[model samples]
Target: MKIAFVGKGGSGKTTLSSLFIRHLAAHEAPVVAVDADINQHLGAALGLDEAEAAALPAMGAQLPLIKEYLRGSNPRITSADTMIKTTPPGEGSQLLRIREDNPVYEACARTVRLDGGDIRLMATGPFTENDLGVACYHSKVGAVELCLNHLVDGPDEYVVVDMTAGSDSFASGMFTRFDMTFLVAEPTRKGVSVYRQYKEYARDFGVTLKVVGNKVLGQDDVDFLREEVGDDLLVTVGQSPWVRAMEKGRPARFDELEAENHLSLQTLRNAAEESYGNRDWERYTRQMVHFHLKNAESWGNAKTGADLAAQVDPAFVLGERSAVPQPS
Candidate 1:
């Protein structure tokens, strides 16, 4: 499943993004964590040094790079439309490239070894890279389409996006592209206030967002936020002075604590469960009349499939099983 995390800055969006990536890695899943926040810092928060995070451009940065490649060094190409190239990555590479416009962007993909497992991260370089005039340009629809196509076509892969904070065009636009969105909110008053707005903004994009209450000191604080929001509170990450200390450049350890033992991580796992639908695929697929009819024989659910297709889209469904005449 492809999931995106968004919230106000300093609201723990990246922290949760990194932690989720770590959690998925431990499960032996092939996961790609895209740091879409143009300003960066996800790598460092996940335990990478400055030089490491500097090498990647969250997906946003890759867009301009694609434009540059299509334009090339030659001044003759006035428009990028005809000049773009889609260079497919070679076999055995971690990136399953959709297509490449220029080879420059692929340089952003680097494999890093982490404690839980290895992660391939791409960052959106800070807005400082582009001149003010160029930075004002809007994102291309083609680029967004290409990225979504890649995600949809991939096999058994998961994408976790760390988007910029707030209702800005960047965050709103990116948030809409995800199969699911997880909003990270802290225990403070400002955090809860922003989270309410975040939920509204997510709904504007027609997404059902799940909330993660971070840095909670106790159950009362979590319950209070839930009461105020009046939504199903997914999971709360208990106040982890250790995790906070690490983010601040202080050396704090997570030695004895079980990563899964934390409430925050538990909610994230639950969110993953719901969004991935790995556990409920049977019920979900059964409900999908067309999909169920196609796979029922192979899956040994043909009886249910026949009944479902009869109730839903019957003509083609019966024809598919060679048991009835197809429609004209």
Candidate 2:
């Protein structure tokens, strides 16, 4: 299962992301946590040792190798072998060597961290390259997806991608890749507005989403969000001073935490487990294609009309289902 987190900046994506790795690791589920945000923080939140962080290069480093292998560089360097080799260095290397067909494999190499449990956690640094364009995002994300596709062989493995805030290319792109996307927002008008915009964009891409309201403080804040979004509140991460301290790299007592504490993280993770099922990307793409292909004309009319609804409703003169048909 591939799970992704998206929210406005400072909306606690990294905190929840770290918690996800910890939760999965505790339960012995192999996880690859990718930090897709430009400014990375998942490492620090997870209490990663400097040495461990330094060893794992961004998955982007393998793009050139991927191109080479695709052009028939070597039969032994399959997608699976390449991902296994490129993972955050640790004992997974031993398993590589045991699979004799892998020519590049070496025994006992530090490639991935296996905490003597069923789970192994690997994290990718954030994407900060600024020459923004669809091609650049696609290239980087393509590599990340390639790596994930290689590591996660079946439904047993899970990937947690911590995405940057706002309705930007990276955030939108993250939605396209994951089976399900979680949109996070704070208890402010700005946060709600941002998620709403993100929701609109996600709809354009036909993304299946669930919203999370983080940093919920009082009844008023909760009521406002409930009114704006609706009663299907996925999870509300309570506002906690300790959470802020954690962001600043300080440790605090759990008792000091408030309602906007990690409780939402627990709720979010639970929803993820419940919502997760066997996913087929091909099926998702087909459904999306149908949506756009079916609504192509109405969307175009909406663009030209004064009111967007005028392009869809039968009551509107310019609508696709209107009484009179207009010229092209």
Candidates' C-alpha lDDT: 0.53, 0.52
lDDT of 1 by residue, 1-328 (tens): 6677877788888887877777667666667666666457778877778777676644544665554443333233333332211211111111223222225336555666655567666665566645466743224222432243223223345677787676553321334445567877776777777667766665644455777787778878888778867674677777566666767866343333345435456566666656665323223222233332343334323422332222222221111122121121
TM-score of each: 0.66, 0.63
> Which regions of candidate 2 deviate over 4 angstroms?
49-55, 67-139, 148-153, 170-174, 204-206, 241-245, 248-263, 278-281, 285-328
Highest TM-score scorer: 1
Best by lDDT: 1
Error of 1 at 304 (Å): 51
Candidate 2 per-residue lDDT over residues 81-173, each given as its tens digit: 233211221111111111122211111112343232333333334445454543344445545543433232335566778876677633213
Instruction: For residue 140, give model 2's deviation from the true position in Å.
Output: 3.0
